[model samples]
Target chain A: MNRIILGVDPGSRATGYGLIAATGESLLHLESGFIALPAQLSHSQRLARIYQRLESLISRYNPEALAVEAVFLAHNVQSALKLGQVRGVVLLAAGQADIPVFEYSPLTLKKAIVGYGQATKTQVLLMVENLLGLTLNNHNTADALALSLCHHFHSRWPQRSVSPAAI
Target chain B: MNRIILGVDPGSRATGYGLIAATGESLLHLESGFIALPAQLSHSQRLARIYQRLESLISRYNPEALAVEAVFLAHNVQSALKLGQVRGVVLLAAGQADIPVFEYSPLTLKKAIVGYGQATKTQVLLMVENLLGLTLNNHNTADALALSLCHHFHSRWPQRSVSPAAI
Candidate 1:
């Protein structure tokens, strides 16, 4: 059995999740995708769909641990609230599986993958592909993989990591 | 045989729920609770357990509608994120039952029951008890009732209300 890890970039509009497994030397990507819930649905309806999708992903991947992106709220209050709700679903999925969850910030993930804390999304995605030896065009999928890679590297070198999601 | 309304005041640490029904010109309080989960659990774990409990509550209460507090943020980003997750569970619970969810805010509820939008937490609690004619202290329970009342009133007179959780 492989030691699998699930990384989630949680958001209300589109939540991206990636599953990866690390061998003694390198990491292998198993699956990655984003769940897009309609914005028009009552917020509750949207959340239900998200929870359902997240649960299915967990069962399908059966990861040993989950690494989700910490909720990032820049300034917009409404956006931040929605993000919190999305993170809730991410955590709920891990909890249901009785798996320990580790949280990573977007910046931390970028720094780990691209060697800079200020790397852009596109830059991080390109570096992730280079590191994984795969050319991925899908931004969400690439971002998810980057998050997974970051978690793997962070787990290996705790001293190089930042304060991940509290929990 | 009553128009029971279930109100939920979701939080990262405790999810407060209340049930009530309108009787002619009065409102009668029913069962309520604080779904307390340890903060040690990862966000996902907390949310999963919350979902299970909320699902049971919805099944038992069979509320006609659900009123949930919207996302409230004030400088504290992590708190907002946690609150968002709980609020999402509230949304998911209401949605799975195909129950229409009504949104409310602290200010609107406080003003409706206490006649002051800026009422302190203590004032709001006192007003909720007086408005609902409760003889005992159920502080969290009262918050739920207030959310329900605010929603009920808004549904009746949409023009006269401002819902905080409108999203």
Candidate 2:
């Protein structure tokens, strides 16, 4: 059976999202984009918009699972708090849809995409494009696609005994 | 006309909530308590529980407005981020019900409840009990009540030209 996965990189001002379908050994990208929220709106207003937009995506894509980037150790406390709020909204959306949600740390995502935990953003982006056979406009979208790819890689070998061969 | 307002003191582990009804100059306390989420659950699961519980509270009280404590400067970035996540969940609940939400800083809440912005938690709790004619078992519920009271005081003088004359 084919499995569809939706990945998200949540941010207060903008949220990146990507969807992919995995069937046996092949992975196909279905959609990739970012949701840019207006800066002038209130925090709650921004969350409401995010909730609605994400809900629409869930309904449209009907992904069997959701994956999101875990919160990193941010230097700015305020920004970190804002990012957490965005993440909460995203989780709530996925929860409402009854989709199982997974999280991948930034380090793990980079390792999956570029064969190195401390890979540069450009290196990760290029690797994602090469793997998915498509060029992405923004790093946010690229990161989301990378998250989906990481999930695909991890889910294949549940035991973690050996890594799946490269796609 | 009578107006019911719900107040929330959002926390990652324990979310405090209070409901009050206002009819003209008189204020009546309806309900007050906290939702304690076990630490073992995943972040999304905890948020889902919070969303469901808060949504139920909104339905039970049928509040016309929702009041929440604004984000405060925290020494720990992770704690602040988690608090923001809880706050976002609270906001999503209110938004889902189409209830107007109001926010008050910790300083403003203390000032509204205890007549001093620098009041101690015990002092605020005592003042809340005196004002509402009930003893609160904990500081969390007191803080939530304080938030609701602050909204009541602020809404009276919509101009915010002058703070409400000592309740």
Candidate 3:
């Protein structure tokens, strides 16, 4: 059976999304990219754009599941709040489409993709490129793809089949 | 001309909203209430519920503008981030309907409602009741109504007419 999973890396100004189709032990990279909002738009306008774009993408791809990063500590509380806002919009879009969302921490995602929780961004990017056999143009997209792989690995792990709490 | 404005008090679990019509320096309350989500629902489900409820409210009232409180200091960074998330959903709903959003800080809202920025919750609630001539059952609804009144007062003040950025 083929299961399609979408991975999301949410940001206040830019959001990255990736699609992967998995069947049995095989996985194929479908699409990966980022949405960058206009600089002149207000925060609300940017969120609106994210919602609209994600809605359209979901309609087109019809993924079976979604994987997203959990909120983590940021240098500034304000930035963390903004990131959370973006994540909210991303979750809303997936919910509207009835897609089940799964969240992974940065450490878990890195470990799943690169075999180490403390792997650097460059290391993770290289591993994602090798695993998916695709060159990534953006770091955010690479992270999103890694999230998709993390979900795939977690789902297959005998003890972790049960999905974690959403959000 | 009858100008209608919608005010929103965004919350992760329960969101409050109010509608008011203004014409020739007169303000009349139209509707006010809150939407509470079940604790069992996932984060995305909660956000989706907020979006749908807000969209329905907008469609019913056809408000010309939306006023929402700006994100401010919370007891914890997690709470602030959650508030920002709810605010994002609120903004997305308003943006989808093409309604211009106006934001007011908590201090500004309190001052507009109770004639002082440091007014207590009971004081603001009483002033909201007296100003709009309606008994408010929920403090969140009262705050939402106060936000509407704030927009009205601020718009008329030549020095405060400039709208704040929507986030």
Candidate 4:
């Protein structure tokens, strides 16, 4: 059976997204890119753009699920608030499309991609490239692809209890 | 000319909304209430509920503007993040409807409704009831109506430059 997954790395300024198809035991990249919100747009406008873009992506690809990074609490109050706003829209888009959403911590993403939870950004990027058999330049896109791959790997191990959260 | 305004007091657990109609020197309360989200619902489900409810409100009232509290930095990082997620959906609903949004600080809300920045919650609620010619029990609804009144008062003074932010 073949399943398509959409992964998103959402931000206030830029939201990166990647799509992949899983067929039996092979993973193939379908698309990867980032939506760049100009500095001139207000915060509300930026959110609107993120929602519209993701809605269009879902419409185009009709993915089976959405994968994203879980909430990271290391940021200060202001930054965390801003980041949460971005994540809110990302989740809203998924909810509107009735697609299941899965969240993976940064450490989990690193381990899935680079075989270690504390792997450096460069190492994760290199390993993702090796796994996907492609050269990637955008860190945001790379992270999004890494998120998709994490879900793919997790879905294969039903005994590990890697089901989507009850959202 | 009569103009409608929607005020929102967004939170993760409950989001309060109120509607007011401005006719010359009079402010009339149209509706006010809070949406209570059960803890059993996940965070994403909560956001989706907020978005859907607000969208229905916008569709029902067709308000000319949305008034909400500005970002309050007093809370800890986690709380701020959760609150921001709620605010994000509020803004998104307004944005999708092409309604302008205005933000007022708590100090400003108190001053507008109670004639002082340091007024107590009871004082603000009483003043809002008096101003709208109604009795209110829900603090969330009271705060939301106060926000609408704040915009009403600010809009009357063109010299104060109380225009909507470029959102």
Better of 2 and 3 by TM-score: 3
* RMSD (Å) of each candidate, 1 decimal: 2.9, 4.6, 1.5, 1.8
Give the clashing residue pairs of candidate 2, or none: none
Pairs of residues clashing in candidate 1: A91-B44, A92-B44
Overall lDDT per candidate, in order of appearance: 0.75, 0.81, 0.85, 0.86
The top-ranked prediction according to lDDT is 4
Pairs of residues clashing in candidate 4: none
Candidate 4: where is the Cα deviation over 4 Å? A161-167, B161-167
lDDT of 2 by residue, B8-126 (tens): 88877688898988888898999999988886766677788889998898888899778887665876877777777787888878877787788777788887888898999999889
Candidate 3 Cα RMSD after full superposition onto the native fold (Å): 1.5
TM-score of 4: 0.95
Q: Give per-residue CA lDDT, model 4, range A12-121, as digits (tens).
A: 77889999999988989999999999988767778888889999999999999899987757368878778878888888888888888898989889988998999988
> Would you list the clashing residue pairs of candidate 3?
none
DockQ for each model: 0.62, 0.46, 0.68, 0.59
Which candidate achieves the best TM-score against the true structure? Answer: 3
Each candidate's number of clashing pairs is 2, 0, 0, 0
Candidate 2 CAPRI level? acceptable
Worst lDDT window (10 residues) for model 1 chain B?
Answer: B157-166
Candidate 3: docking tier? medium
